[model samples]
Target: MPILEDLKEYAERATGLHRPGKRQAAELPHPRKPHVVRFRDDGLVPNHPRWPLTLYRSAVRIDERHDPAAVLEDLFEANGWGDSWRNGIYDYVHYHSRIHEVLGIARGKGRVRFGGNKGRIFTLKAGDVAILPAGTGHQCLSEEDDFLVVGAYPPVGTYDECTEVEDRPKALQRIPKVPVPRKDPVYGADGPLLRLWKKSK
Candidate 1:
């Protein structure tokens, strides 16, 4: 029998996972202000104090002609975010204590709850993007069957998912130290991320 990791890989491959179009089509995003929201550490979540979560609505153009995932993968790669993956959101509340994350919606729609229990819920659709600072809690509230998301991260941080109650202490210690990304995952060197985050600091 194959190892568990091999089995998972086989399943993903059989189901057509991580495959995007060969065409590279990412360009400038539509001009729009990133909607920013900050979350307080709710004991369990350890949300970032200085950087707020940023949301970009219809930031990129994803249409029927181009593979949506391909579009985002190119967009993110061009903006200096790498290690891209295509998938759906996790239903349970979870967060990354070490790395910041960027999620670009490729297909369908979903309602996602951000922050801890006191966090807000936002409906996301295709062409949308959400940038999560380190230690920010997020969960999938509801989603369409065809909902697909393209996720990537900045070059600076490591990726570690923290969910259980026991992950708090270290999360608190490490969350603040996650270095700010040099570029926005959506817009690039001149994007609003640099302005907003630096202004907050």
Candidate 2:
């Protein structure tokens, strides 16, 4: 409920930014792991075992005429994903063992670190999107003043934050139970997620 309120506030605050605008549809096979990346962990990110992290560079190609945030929301919603929210990434490290998360860089730019304290950092800008498997750690390393991000999760279960060491075992149990999302957050049914994730399974 509180998250819903946050989402509402974010939407209202950006109302003028979502007006209809022309832009090209996202082109896929754009880039996958290594350059974009797939972070792995043993039991560090307990629930994140089977799925690899995914990042798409310049996935949407932003411009003054289009709203990257609005387009990302529509894509996730159409695919039955919910719990959408808009904001910058948290400055401190955190992860959710309950659900996979997708973050679209809607405005400005920022640097994010993934996979705990030893994780690498990547710079992101508008039109970039990151799909984090459940339990993977992420934190904002730096950002521009205008940085804004749109994030959403699959429409199956509620999410819980796990920043403490004691939460590991229970989080591990919960993560595997989370069903693989039926649609890719950005590319719908035929997206790269299925192929990439299926290989891991």
Task: Report lDDT per candidate.
Answer: 0.84, 0.73
Candidate 1: list runs displaced more than 4 Å.
1-24
Error of 2 at 177 (Å): 1.9
| Candidate 2, superposed: residue stretches over 4 Å from native | 1-17, 20-36, 42-44
Per residue, candidate 1 scores C-alpha lDDT tens digits across 70-187 of 6787778777898888788999999999999999998899999999888999999999999998999999999998888889999988999999889998888998899889988877
Question: lDDT tens string, model 2, 33-104?
Answer: 323355665355553777777888877656566456666666566666767787889998888988889998
Leading candidate by lDDT: 1
What are the TM-scores, per candidate, against the unseen true structure? 0.87, 0.82
Clashes of each: 0, 0
Q: Candidate 1, after superposition: displacement of residue 62 in Å?
A: 1.2
TM-score (C-alpha) between model 1 and the true structure: 0.87
The local lDDT score (0 to 100) that residue 166 gets in candidate 1 is 100
Name every residue pair that clashes in candidate 2: none
